[model samples]
Target: MATTDDSFNGLTEYCDECELDTLHEVSVQIRTESTKKENAQFSREPYRVSECQRCGHRTSQRMNNA
Candidate 1:
């Protein structure tokens, strides 16, 4: 399970419209992992859609819940 205190430090990517790399503000976040697994130690796959804080450019990415 992911923690609330998880760091957002290394989660940035390039924004084409902004013409620079900027931190994005998360617009939507969804967890796509099954909760009915036999083992309780399974990982999670989170889908996130964010917008560039500088130019309002939108992007989507899948995050590893390691």
Candidate 2:
């Protein structure tokens, strides 16, 4: 399980209509060689993107993964 500290944290985007910063919750599922000791070729890594519900703004900020 990945913790919030394991993610990069930052503002996902700025809503021009609301004039407020939209916070995003982004998660990246990575498959590494170290993680696949049992099965090296069975890594299903994917990225997750979500926008702020309040502002309806979307952005894939790389900084919000801490």
Candidate 3:
């Protein structure tokens, strides 16, 4: 079997519903938002969203802003 750095290689994460660490499918996404100022400063943020392969629970968090 071949493996890369992604979660496809049987990566496991904590799932709230499952209540135990389980395999999770992870994905990357960008979130766009503007600061609450007169001239709003728009920004694009990256995040890793993961879903438990067994229970369908989601765990998401913003990644380091690059």
Candidate 4:
């Protein structure tokens, strides 16, 4: 089961558009993966986002549950 604190590894939208208050299903992907090295590194995926179908506005923000 997924928990509130569970770090989901997929796309997540957490904000609404100011123009239309429409929710956008932003696309998110794992730009990079963790290595077995001492420290882990993270890379943000490109912002090749799409607009909300209902409002025609871009997503306000993108996030991961993790």
Candidate 5:
């Protein structure tokens, strides 16, 4: 269960420990990345991080800012 005061975002995901689709706490984070070429330009990318409420299993994905 999520409380209004604590729940800013929530995501539905499958948890291996739970073995079901459960609600997860969601948050956005910025990660720095650079190419492995000679001119390696650094860039910050936004990622969506979700943590399972039951098992605390965490996963991250690059956010589609489209």
Candidate 6:
């Protein structure tokens, strides 16, 4: 399972409509990718959906683990 941290919790993003980095609500969707290897486990990726609390502006970003 993917856990949300303070950095990517959607409150730090800049909202164009609000013209600032304001509070936002974040929703995460987990996707599993199947591997062809015989003993390989599936890889999990999370897509973050964020909506501005003030203006309801929405944006999405895929999380990268590196």
Each prediction's Cα RMSD? 8.5, 9.5, 5.1, 10.1, 4.8, 7.2
| Pairs that collide, model 1 | none
Candidate 2 per-residue lDDT, tens place, 1-66, comes to 222333357434455556765555554544333465687666444445455546665543233333
Winning candidate number (lDDT):
5
lDDT of 6 by residue, 11-57 (tens): 55678899987778888888665565653455767888888777899
Over 4 Å off, model 3: 1-10, 35-41
Using Cα atoms with residue i matched to residue i, what is each candidate's TM-score against the true structure? 0.41, 0.28, 0.65, 0.27, 0.61, 0.51
Better of 1 and 4 by TM-score: 1
RMSD of 3: 5.1
lDDT of predicted model 4: 0.42
lDDT of 5 by residue, 1-66 (tens): 333333456756677778887878878898766766544445668898888988899888898655
Cand. 6 TM to true fold? 0.51
Question: How high is the lDDT of residue 46 in model 4?
Answer: 38
Error of 5 at 45 (Å): 0.2
Off by over 4 Å in 6: 1-12, 31-45
**What is the C-alpha local distance difference test score of each model?**
0.61, 0.48, 0.70, 0.42, 0.74, 0.71
How far is 17's C-alpha from truth in model 2 (Å)? 9.9
Listed per model in order, the count of residue pairs whose N, CA or C atoms clash below 3 Å is 0, 9, 0, 0, 0, 0
Question: Candidate 5 vs candidate 6: which has greater TM-score?
Answer: 5
* Candidate 3 per-residue lDDT over residues 1-66, each given as its tens digit: 112345644567667798787887778898766666654445667888887779888767899855
